[model samples]
Target: MTQKTFLVTGAAGFIGYHTSERLLARGDKVVGLDNLNSYYDVRLKESRLARLQQHENFRFIKCDLADKAGMEQVFRQHQFDVVINLAAQAGVRYSLTNPHAYTDSNVTGFLNVLEGVRHSGVPHLVFASTSSIYGANTKQPFSETQNVDHPLTLYAATKKANEVMAHSYAHLFDFAVTGLRFFTVYGPWGRPDMALFLFTKGILEGKPIDVFNHGDMVRDFTYVDDIVTGVVAAADNPPEGDKNWDGDEPNPATSYAKYRVFNIGNNKPVKLMEFIEAIEESVGKKAIKNLMPIQPGDVPSTCADVSALEKAVGFKPDTSVKVGVENFVRWYREYYRV
Candidate 1:
């Protein structure tokens, strides 16, 4: 593969940090951008950015995705071979209460990113989508071709918006744009609001952890490293215009233009209890569970059909839950000195 300069949005974020590191490791120039919002703990984001700063090929810029002028200026100054956008306001349950935040970051911020790519003439743009867009579709294993018209939460709606928005740009600007619907990703330096992080913290602190839906939920929990690998592979192989795409019976995953969507997931759904058990085994302690009804803006199950991803990128996420949880627990212990 040829080396090139890449622009990574949300470089201080969990997935963004990992993605930028992978690009730099492969002898690519990386310019990382982030707003460093206090949505979670800013300290955690800072720590992740600190590690990336150590890389000679990595450069950091503190900028919000919603800042139109700043975004345009950056694009004008730097010529990016590919734009990997991983920044957004993330959180499903939180969106229920703070709905405006979702639109501000996911919608407005995303528009800024699209405009930057458009004006800069970036050939390929790979962005982060979510499996939550499956919404009310009661399919066993969600595929990219499934209808995602019914989104259960504001966060899901915003992500679905991004997919369509990018598709339009791909058609009009004639740029190769790919959207990745990432499943439940967890690993070292993971987000604090994610299930594994909360569960591990509660168990270690001897506090009762809330088990929603009476522990009936199932998820395709993907490891972060595996997700990063899949992301890099997708970035390297931008989607070309599908010559065989039929307009009469359209496929939601791909268009006649240089646009496509793929799911990057573990493919194996793990029960809520089974996932908790893995964390328990890693921590050597049982969690104090408070079983409760399912909260609003949440689903009971989610699985991914990553066949399209494999066909396009020649790779799929295969990390087991046991191994992923162990890695997180080990990292958590060291990071917090638990």
Candidate 2:
């Protein structure tokens, strides 16, 4: 394989850091960009970056995606073969109170990324979209072909906006663009805000864990390693314009332009209570469950149809929830000295 120089936004982020590590492991040069905002524990972000810094092939940039001038300068400085965008104001419930953050990061920040990729002549731009965009759809397994016009939260809306924005850029600029709709991702070095981390911490501390929707929620919990595998594969194989694409019966997942969307998920949906049980088993402690009603902007379930990703990249996420949760618990214990 030819060595390629890649730029990954949110390199300090969970998925971004893992993706960069994968690229570097393959002897590719990676320039990781992140603002390291206070959305979560900044120490965790720094720790992730520290691990990346140990690699000679890795470079770090302290920049936000919304910073147009800074983004332009970075693009001018580096000749990236591919740009994988994973940075965003993430969280469905958080979007309810802090709505502007989503617009700034997901919407405007994404615009900056698109402009950077466009001007830099980057061949492939693989960005992170969310399964949350499948909001309000009662489909058993969420597919990229389904209509995602009815997003329940502001965060999902912004991500949905990103899909259309990238498509427009692909049509006008003729660049290869692929959007990946990620399911619930968890693993070692996972985000503290995610359920696995929260449940683990709460269980170990003998604190009550918030069981949302009366513990009736279902999620396609994907491991970060599997997510990174799909991401790298997509980056390596950029989408080509679909020649058989028809305008009359246009598909939401593909187009006549060089743009496509694929769902990267574990395909298996596990119940919320079952996930908590896995955590409890891993921690050797049962959680004090505080059953609560479903919060606003929250969905009852999320299951992905990853057939398109498998067809495109010859891979799909197959990690089981039990194994994935155990991995997270192991990491959490070591990281927090529990």
Candidate 3:
């Protein structure tokens, strides 16, 4: 396979930074795009960007996906062979307070991406979906075949909508699109709003860590390295249209169009208390747990069924939560001089 030029949206973000760095290490040219919104600490995002700037193959542009003209210009100027859309208004709880962010970034912004791919003749478009889309479903391990019609939060809804939107473009324009449903991703350089980062920070500061769902929750936390590996593999192996796909019994995982969805997770759901213990072990400090009820739009648990991803890519996420947490804590301590 030819090493193609890749465009990774949200390249300043945790997952995006890792993905872009890996691509650069492989000698692939990468055009990274980000708006650098103040949803979290801009300093952290800048810090991430600083690391990527060291790589010779990485070229970054400050732009939002919602900017149709800017996105169109990028598509027109660069002959992007693959586009990995990771930019979005992330967080289930944040959706409750800021619904417009989802609409503008996830919905409107995503539409612009589709337009770019449709016009630019890009072969594959791999975008980030979320496990939160499995909302209101009581399934043990969420499968790609399951119907994701019931989303509890605007964030989940936007992701679910992205899958549908991508499918439509694939059918209409013959573009290869794959939507990756990432389970709770964590590691060094992870978002501050995420659990592992928040818990580690609070524990180090001798502050109380908010334990949602009264510490009864579980998360299939995938490490950042594993996620980028899966993502790059998916980007290289674009989905072909299911020739034998039956319209009567539609399969959500694969379609008659060049579209598919796969869950990228550890496939091992760890309890919230266990996760906290892992952090405590890594940091050598016990967290002051402030037990609280489940917040609005927050799911109690998430476990991904990554068999399909394994079958497609011949790989699965194998990073243990303990190791992942330890790495984060180590980086945190060094980064903050704690």
Q: What are the candidates' C-alpha RMSDs?
A: 0.7, 0.7, 0.8
CA lDDT scores, all candidates in order: 0.94, 0.93, 0.93
- Residue-wise C-alpha lDDT for candidate 3, range 1-338, written one tens digit per residue: 45779999999999999999999998899999999999999999999999999988889999998898999999999999999999998988888889999999999999999999989899999999999999999887999999889999999999999999999999999999999999999999999999998999999999999999899999998999999999999998999999999999999899999999999999999999999999999889899999999998888889999999899998677788888899999999999899
- Candidate 1 per-residue lDDT, tens place, 1-338, comes to 78899999999999999999899998999999999999999999999999999999999999988888889889999999999999998989999889998898899999999999999899999999999999999977999989999999999999999999999999999999999999999999999999999999999999999999999999999999999999999999999898999999999999999999999998999999999999999999999999999999899999999999898888767678999899999999999999
Q: Candidate 2, residues 125-220: lDDT per residue as tens digits?
A: 999999999889998799888999999999999999999999999999999999999999999998888998888888999999999999999999
State the lDDT at 152 in candidate 2: 92
For model 1, what is the error of residue 325's alpha carbon versus the real structure, in angstroms, after optimal superposition? 0.7
What are the runs in model 1 whose C-alpha is more than 4 Å off? Answer: none
Error of 1 at 333 (Å): 0.5
| TM match of model 3 to true structure | 0.99
User: Model 2: how large is the Cα RMSD against the reference?
Assistant: 0.7
lDDT of 1: 0.94
